[model samples]
Target: MKLRNLPPLALAAAVGVALTACSPSEPEPEESAPESASPSAPPTSEAAPAAVLPTGEPQVLATGLDVPWSVAFLGETALISSRDDGDVLELLPDGGTRVIGTVDGVVHDGESGLLGLAVDDQGRLYAYSTGEDGNRIERYGFTGEPGSLALGTGETLLEGIPAASYHDGGRIAIGPDGMLYAATGDAGNPDDAQDLDSLGGKILRMTLDGAVPEDNPFAGSLVYSYGHRNPQGIAWAADGTMFAAEFGQNTWDELNIVEPGGNYGWPEVEGIAEEGDFIDPVQQWSPEEASPSGIAVVEGTVFIANLRGEVLRAVPVADPGTATEYYAGEFGRIRAVTASPGGDLWFTTSNTDGRGDPSGDDDRLVGVEVG
Candidate 1:
């Protein structure tokens, strides 16, 4: 059955390298990736018989979001996070929205406002947002039912992640392993990306209780991988192949197949270097065309939301080297994309965030059926 756009539409819109291993305290910044890395896991490709992506136009689900940054669903109900105001919105059936509640202690800055959101199996809501101190992760009790959703008191899970107006990489998701994963930027300090002790410029993995995973690449540390500039997207395939999308300085943006304890070259290198020391990106695009952010993988296809590129890009899991573009310049500044609970693809726009030209309903939530 081909899913068509909702009939009663008010408005609609749509949408890393590794570090090398090195010696103890003397580990050089330019060292190649660690030796424990499994060979670069290739994306699921056409050869693997991946499903085709939907070409139909996106269907608008809701409108009037204030600089919305991320979206997560609890069962059938959708929860959206706003950056400027730190409001969590519940999407209504009539293409409208209502405020569930505002998150506490959110301090909005350039790109350092309320950002990523994730829901756990225990019905807990984990939020990654910027606080007065820095970027932090908090767990909130998700209470009440849908439509009447409310947030209970929060427990701080982690804090003091580096924050900057521009490079505050803030995106969180739960891996198939049921662990909480966060992508953090370099926080405007490139050297921090190479420091294993620094939380910036790396993908972090932690238990639900905020403890570092014992099996992490680094011992007694939450840093799963390091040497990233501004990684904003991370997703895993059914086979557990991890993929990440990152922003480059001025040359390139990257899509990488992540490896445990892998080191992706950051200030040392931008795109593919073919250097054995650092892991290379599976694909690279010019920054003007691919400031990629939040991404999702559905049915062996990796869906990416590009900010400046202003397009939704799809890459086959088996063939991550290439991508197909959709809705280019139709809806301004695509921000986040997620697999909807209804088996469709849901995405949100970011035009109202002091950038692109937004319509009356500039920041909107939209979706498309994918089967």
Candidate 2:
């Protein structure tokens, strides 16, 4: 069935970069203009956000990203990113990249492949990927060697997430309390979102090692919240409020305020409801305008990358309940977005990975200066 025709909950089920090895420090804040001011037009050249950088040249953080899917910074000098084609890259201090390893047998058909990535206080790297049977999460040691990990040695930290050629949930991040947080899709089964035990269409909170956390809202279960159709972006701003970006069934894709055990109105509700036991979106936009993916919260603004819109969107968060958007269209087919140590924003382009045509540079890691 087409997405637009899907039931209110059906759309809910559907659906980064750096290189520095430095000390862990607080994320630099992203700047925001007055909410009432109009957004500046996109730059004609490959330059960073002039608002963030008066010098105004978009810097190439890394290149040859190989269908880059997700990214997370390890420290100020080094960062890592994974590709949909199964490759993982490490960006070093020298501004060059090296292949750390390949996620073997990642089912790359449709939208399923190597997706979300995260790291813990212990420095172990975690990833969400399409396994042979379903989507899985695993962890590896940080050896600093490209394509040289003990690939077979990493344990499957979590397994049995529902997987379809499409709707496979892939975003993973470690929360402040040392718990792993993940956003899952509906696996094309609208009703699956309402089923707490199915592991599909839910936001899960688990241990860094994959055990269910005892304090989880659903006691003895990994489900932190239920009733999500397909959530693509997850982030925690300096204030620690968790926010998610989700693709809609057809009408409105959403940026949501996520809480433990919160029901986000998937399968039965989309953006907001006239009346329902579900949380509402802080920000909603047309699907064509923003097929939102990975999200990063710097200072108070949330930077959302778009696959369909092919631009980077900034949402200023004065209040948790509402925000406005700023569009910078310099990047085409942006798939992942993150923050850098030098007070800049980083993003990846996914044009050559099958969604659209390559524009000069098929896939590149670019940086945007922000407040």
Candidate 3:
């Protein structure tokens, strides 16, 4: 959600303007063709059958969310985080929602607020939020079931991460190794991306208790990989390879296959740099084409939610660079995407976050079939 200063005309032309939760009320005005058009339909001919693209419609699960940032599952229920309001809401199977708890000391600035969320096998909940001091991760224990849920006092897992108005990266997930993995931005300072000693601009690995794992790439440090501008999505494939979605400054957004102690070359390189020392992104897109936010891997495909692109891109795990656009310009400014228990994809819209046009049901959660 960084890069907030781009002109609306440029953004609208690059990616269509945000639509309502369901669809666009009016047709978008024609503009100059973008560098690449959204995947087009195959031409029909008597010689051959038309190609069939992956097709699935989004079902709106819940509405009236105020900038819902992340979604995590606790059993069959879904827990959603509201960025500006610091509220954690529980969405039941019947589409009912209830406030489970409000995170204390959240500062809802330009792009900093309550962000990423994760749940462990023990049903413990983890949240990343912006506080007065900086960005912090907190763990909470849940007491009740879906309808009536109560959260315990939050236990601070980690703190002292740099925070800023724009680039405070905030995505956390439990890796397949049973360790906690967190992504942090450069806090609006590009130089911080190259500084390995700083916690900003890196993927951090730690135990559930916030202790550095003994097998970490960096001995006695939590830094797993360095040289990232603002990475907001982390998901592990069944084979244990980690993939992250990152926001680029102005030129490129990246989908990176993360390796331990790898350098991504942030300030030095934006997208695919054939430079010797830097690891290139598996896939790259223009920032206008993809202000990519949250990502999830389901059934061997990586589903990336795009904010500026206004689409859910399904990229096959075997094929990294290619993607099929689903619901392009339909759900509006997708902020978070996660795999549901039933093997479907659940995502949230960000139209209410002072950027896109808000429909009456703006910032809602929608579900789509993945397989």
Provide the overall lDDT of each model, using Cα atoms, as 2-decimal numbers: 0.81, 0.70, 0.81
Global CA lDDT of candidate 2, please?
A: 0.70
**Residues 303-350 of candidate 2: C-alpha lDDT, one tens digit per residue:** 788888766777655443333343335556888887765666778888
Query: Which residue ranges in model 2 land beyond 4 Å of their true spot?
Result: 1-55, 77-80, 144-152, 320-328
What tens-digit string does per-residue lDDT give for candidate 1 at 1-371? 22343323433322100101112222111112223223454534444546457544456677777898899988777889999888888887566788887878899878888999999888888999998889999998877887788888989999999998879889999999999999999989999988999999999999999999899999999999998999889999878888899999998898888898998988888888878879898888888887999999998788999999988888778767767777677678999999877668889999999988988766878777665
Candidate 3 lDDT, 281-342, residue by residue in tens: 87788988789999998856788899999987876665566677777787779999987786
Angstrom error at residue 79, model 3: 0.2
Candidate 1 local Cα displacement, residue 222, angstroms: 0.3
Clashing pairs in 3: none
TM-score of each candidate structure, all chains considered together: 0.89, 0.81, 0.86
Off by over 4 Å in 3: 1-55
Worst 10 residues of 2 by lDDT: 1-10
